[model samples]
Target: MRLRLKGARVVDPGSIDDYKDIIIFDGMIEAVIDPSSPYPPVMLDSSDPSSVTKGLKSEENDTNYSEAGKIGVDNFPVEEGDTNYSEKGKVEASPTVSGEGYTNCSKEADITEIDLAGMVVVPGLIDMHVHLREPGQEYKETIETGLKAAARGGFTAVCPMPNTNPVNDNAQITAFMVNRAKSLGGTRLYPVGAITRGLKGENLAEYGDMKQAGIVAITDDGRPVENARVMRRAMEYARGLGIPVISHAEDLSLAGDGSMNEGIVATRLGIKGIPNAAESTVVMRDIALAELTGARLHIAHVSCEESVDAIRQGKKRGVNVTAETAPHYFTITDEAVAEYDTNAKMNPPLRTEQDRLAVIEGLSDGTLDIIATDHAPHSLLEKDVEFDRAAFGIVGLETALGLSLQLVNNGSLTFDELIEKMSKKPAALLNINNDIVPGNPADLTIIDPDAFWSVNPETFFSKGRNTPFAGYHLRGEVYMTMVQGTIAYHRTDGGQ
Candidate 1:
C-alpha cells in the first residue's frame, strides 16, 4: 500500500524539510516532496481525527499521586461524531502504480492521501531500554501488548531488557523473543541479552551466540553486577562481539531496602531511602571499567546530579560512554512520593528539584546522549500494595513523548533537539540509522504535538496501569504510527 502524509512538521535532520509531503510505498519512504509541488491536494475523509486538532489543555507540572483507573478495553477515548475505524478514511491505494506516484513521475490518485494538517511528524522514536515482561511474566505484558503501547507513544522500535524468568542469556531465548515480536506485527523489538548466566552476575553468557540471534546489547538489568572483575570480563567479551555493555548502575548495599530517593522526603515519610550516591558511585565505577576495557558502556536510568557530572566528565575524558534518563526523572521529583505513592517508586528513584534541573542541563549540554522511557510495566496486583513493599516501576511506554516534550515547553530543549534525543541519538546508540529519505524503511511516527490529553492509565494499551503522571494534563499525542509501511497503530476517531 502507498500513503501520502501531508501538512505535518518534520524537524528530524535529513527528513527532507520543515514541512513536506512524505510518500511511502512497499514498506519504505519513497519520497519527501515540497508541499506545493505537483501532486493531488491531500484530503482526509472521515479520518481518524487524531491528527486534526491539538489535544486538551492541561498542566505538565501537576503533582497528584493518585492511582489511575482500572485497565479498560479499546481504552482510547472516542470523540463525538466519530465513525468506525475500518470504514472511515481507509487508504485506498492501488497496487498497480506502486512506487511511481511517490516520485511525482506519475499520477497521484494511485495512492491513499492522509491529510496531517496541524500536526508534527518526525522519524519514528526509538527507546534503548524497556521491559516488555515477556517469556515469563506474560500476565504483565507481551511483545504484542507492549509494542502497542510503544506505538501509541510514537515509538517504532524498542529494546526490551532481558530480566525475564529464564533471562535472555542464551541465543535460543534471544531468538525466541525477537521472533515472537516479529510475529506480533508491531514495534521492532531488539532483545538485550543477559550479561551473565541467568543474570546471576558470575559467569558470562553466550554473547557471540546471542548477537547472532538478534541481541543488540547485553545487560543484567533489574539488578546491578556486584562483582567488578566479572563485569569487566563481560565488557571485554561484549567489546569483542561488537555489542555495547549496558550497566544498571546501582549499589545494593547503599540502596538496601530503599523504596524512594534518600532525601528529606524519605525521612519525612519515615521510609528507607536510597542515596544519590547509590547510582552515581556505580556510574563512576562503570565509567572507569569502560575506560580500562575500551568497551562501549551505557548507563541506564541516570537520575542524580552526581551521576550527570560523572557522565559529563567521562565524555570529556574520551571514554566510550553514553547515558539515558526516563521521563519521570525530568518531569517529577522525589517530593511526588509524599503520599506513600508506589507508582513513583522506580529504581534509581526520582531525585530532588536540584537534581532534576541538573538532568535538564545535561540534556542541553550533551552530557546525556539519549532519552529512553525505561518503559517498565508492572501489574496492578503488584503495585496496589504498601509503597515500601510494592514493585519498583510504573508503565511509561504511552507517556514518554508527551512527557519529554515538557522540555521543549520549558525551553530546556528545542523541538529539533527533542526529536534528536528521542529518535536519532537513540538510533545512533544502536549503530542504526532511520533517516527519513527514499529507500529507507517506512518507520515513521506522526504526532500532533499540540494535541492535549490527560494521563489516564485506564486508556493505556499495556497490561500495566500504573503511572506517576496520572491525573496530570499533558500536551502532545501520537496520531499514527507506521512500521515498515504498515499501520501498526492508528487512533481511530471513527477503520483499517
Candidate 2:
C-alpha cells in the first residue's frame, strides 16, 4: 500500500531544520515532498469510519468521481469559494467542488495521509544494552516477550546481553539467539558475546569467532572483569576483530560486602556501602589499557563524577572510548535508598545528587554518547525479598522514553538533541545505519511530546514490576511504533 503522510513535521537529526511531508510505499519511504503538493492521480479514501483506506482504484478517469466515490475525495471538505460561486454569467458551481483547479487543496489528503501536527517523527530508537534472557532463563525474560516490551517502548532494535544461565560465549549460541529473535520476536536483535569464558573473568571468550558470527560487541555485564591482564588481553583480541569491548566497571575489592552507594544515606540506613572509587578506579584502568593497546573500549552504566571526569579526560586525550549511562542514574540519587527500596538498588548504585547532576552535564555536553535502560527483568518473588538480599535491577523497557521526555520538557535538553542521543548516536556508536530518509527501512516512532500520563507497573508488558517510578507522572508518551513498515505497537488509551 502507498501511504502519503501529509503535513508531518519530520525531525531528522542528520540535517539542520529539516521538516517535510513524506510518502511511504512498499514498506519504504518514497519521497519527502512539500505539504501543499498535489495529490497523486490515485489516492485512498479516508472518509469511512474505519481508519484504513479501502479499494485502490483510479479517480481521475471516472466522470462520476464526485458521487461519494471511495478513491476521490470521499469526505474531503470543499474549499472556500467552491460552493455556487458564479462569475457574472458563468454556470452555477455545484453544491460541492470537483477536483479540477483545487490549487490549495484541503489540508486533508487521504486515510493514508497521516496528520502529524504537534507531533515529532523521529528515527526509531536503538538500544545497545539490553538483557533478553532466552535459551535458558525464559521465566525471567524470553526473546519474544522482551521484544514486545521493546516495541511498546519505541525501540526498533536492541543488543541483547550475553549473561544467561548458559552464557552466549560461542558462535552456536549467538547464532541461535539471532535466528530466534529474527523469526519469533518482532524487534531487531544484535547478540553481544561474553568477554570471558562463563563470565568468570579468568579465560577470555571466543571474541574472534563471536564477531565472525555477527556479534556487535562483547561484555560480561553484571560481572566486571577484575583481572587487568585478562581484561587487557580481551580488549586487544576484540580490537583485532574490529569490535568494542564494553566494560561494566567495578572493583570488587572496594565493593566488599556493600549493597548500595557509599554516602550519608547508606550510613543513616545502616547498610553496607560501595564507594564511588570502585567504579572510577576501573574506568581509569580501562582508559590506560585502551591507550596501551589502541583498542575501542566502551563503559556501561557510568555513574559518579569521578568516572565522568576520567572519561572526559580520556576523550580529551586520543584514547578511543565511548560510554552510556542509564536513566535511573541521572534521575535518582542515593538518597532514594532512605526507604530501603530495593527497586532503586541497582548496580553501580545511585550516587549523590552532585553525581547525578554530573551525569546530566555529561550527557548535555556530549561527553556521554547514549542513554539506555539496562532493561533487566526480575520476577516479583525475587524482587520482593529483603532489601539487602533482593535483586539489583529494574524494569525500564516501557518507561525509558517517558522519563527521557521529562528531561526535555523540564528544559534540560532540546527535543532534537534527545532524539539524536536515543536513536542516531547509539546507532553510530554500534556501527549501524541510522536511516530516516527515502528508500530506507520504515523504522520510525511517533511521539506526542505534550501528552501526560502516570506510570503504572500493572500496565507494563514485562512480567517484572520492580520499577521505582510506578506512580510517578510523566510527559511525552509514544503513540505509535513502526518496525520495518509494520505497526508493532499502537496506544489504545487515547493518550495521544
RMSD of each candidate relative to the true structure: 13.3, 8.2
TM-score per prediction, in order, is 0.85, 0.85
Please report, in order, the local distance difference test score of every candidate based on alpha carbons. Answer: 0.81, 0.78
Residues 17-88, candidate 1: write the lDDT tens digits.
Answer: 477777787898876765533232222244444221112112132111010010011122234444332232
User: Candidate 1's C-alpha lDDT?
Assistant: 0.81
For candidate 2, the per-residue lDDT at 427 reads 84
Model 1 weakest 10-residue run by lDDT: 64-73
Indicate the TM-score of model 2: 0.85
Model 2 residue runs over 4 Å out of place are 16-18, 39-111
